[model samples]
Target: MQIKHQVVTRTPLGGFTLVEVLASVALISIVAAYFVHIQIQQVQERVVEALAQDVLTLANASMTYFSQTNEWPDQENGDCDDLIATLGGLGAFPVAVGGYQGPDGITLATRCEDTGDLGRTLLISVNFPFGADDQAQMLMSYLPTSVNEDVDDDEGPVVTHYVATPRRASERYRFYRIALEERGIFRLSKPDCPGRRNDPAHILLPQAICMPASAQGLGGYFFDEIDDDDDYWELQLLVADGEENNNVSDFMEFSGIPTCDGNRVYVGAITYCETR
Candidate 1:
């Protein structure tokens, strides 16, 4: 009878109300939004960094290719922006000539035209005056080749070409180097590698395999380095990017002068620069 007198209080068994639940959802949403914002910013930053790295890579590769082929590209006479529009191949060529001409007048213009895609002209011109063999170690020098090129002066503008009389590894794989400044380790601006097989037919292909760097760099020897006969000879090169783009600058290299026993001792090197 005494236990029956005990009173029982009802306890509430309710969970969160609708308003509180909604508020919690809203707070969570805000936090999620903040996290998403941070993620987006990080992604953008990564994208910009990747682009910068790509530019550097393209610059190095393009310059390397130019050295191998002795052909420049994506450079013209006018504004590079529009020029690059046509030739998609120009990687870092300054788009639009900024009221100033590049070293070569045509480089700015050629780099400014609109086209389909980036490309290179494959032209090679050679000059070998056989008679001028004053016994000189035939030396060839290479200059800075461009990624884009143009020629504006000559009527029916003549495309420039590049080549070596005997461009072979075993033939003239001796110590020869070319550069803006004389150096000990560089090679003349040309395909340092000969095709696996060295022959006329293989060398004439649209895209011939570049030769690897020769231990010496220069061809063994053009003719004789002795001036006993007093023969005056010179050889020049003109390389192009493709049939569309013309040669922009005039490249000049030197042949090594060797001293001989019969003739007065004469050994000299050649130095060249740009023409703007």
Candidate 2:
């Protein structure tokens, strides 16, 4: 057997090419970026949802306080800090109820007043801090139409800085009183109104215009304009009814005022009401 020298072809151990390494790195970076984007979006959604729920919860708490104490949690000029103080400081109100200190990048504007029709009215407006345009828009989506419609139509981006008070009975009374004081008229032309018609009875006019004989000031009367609509005035009477039992005919009686359609009353002009 001739011992033939077997030439062992020694192939050098191969390493990854620069292009392949770069491609792998690029793929990993893309996957990481995608996951990060998803996480960011989820975080944002959770933040806004929590914010919306907190706002509703605070409003409800304020209403409950008003219902029980015939007063609001904070004063007319109260802001978020004032609310925190009014609610017995942190770990109270929102914190106690929802485990939330309040929405980030937002402020609170609250007013409590004695609306003649609605016993004790509370107005809570959520305001976005300056330079929080994104947060404002996000909040607008969650806000009710009552607040969203207030956004200026001839605006750049509908800078919805203010959110109207909820349409609950306690809140609507505040809004109704504010409209009368500022606009000298309270017209529920929004679809939420029962008839959506500008009836003199439904269309609350200043006492001067409708009831010249009644007290000159915007007193505890719902309608001054007298018309053939007995039904409308009847509804107003329910509001003016002092007897607690007669005030709310139905549990859903809106602000103790009767409505033809029983829809949520919307008064667009009244942004807020100051305490008396």
lDDT of the candidates, in the order given: 0.31, 0.44
Over 70-176, each residue of candidate 1 has an lDDT whose tens digit, in order, gives: 33333333332333333344444344445312221222122212221222322221111233111111111121231212334332222222212122221322222
Top lDDT hit:
2
Model 1 worst lDDT run, 10 consecutive residues: 200-209
**Residue lDDT tens for model 2, 93-183:** 6444432355454555555544443343455556554455565567768866425324444432222223233334232332243223222
**TM-score of each predicted structure versus truth:** 0.30, 0.40
Q: Candidate 2, overall lDDT?
A: 0.44
Error of 2 at 262 (Å): 51
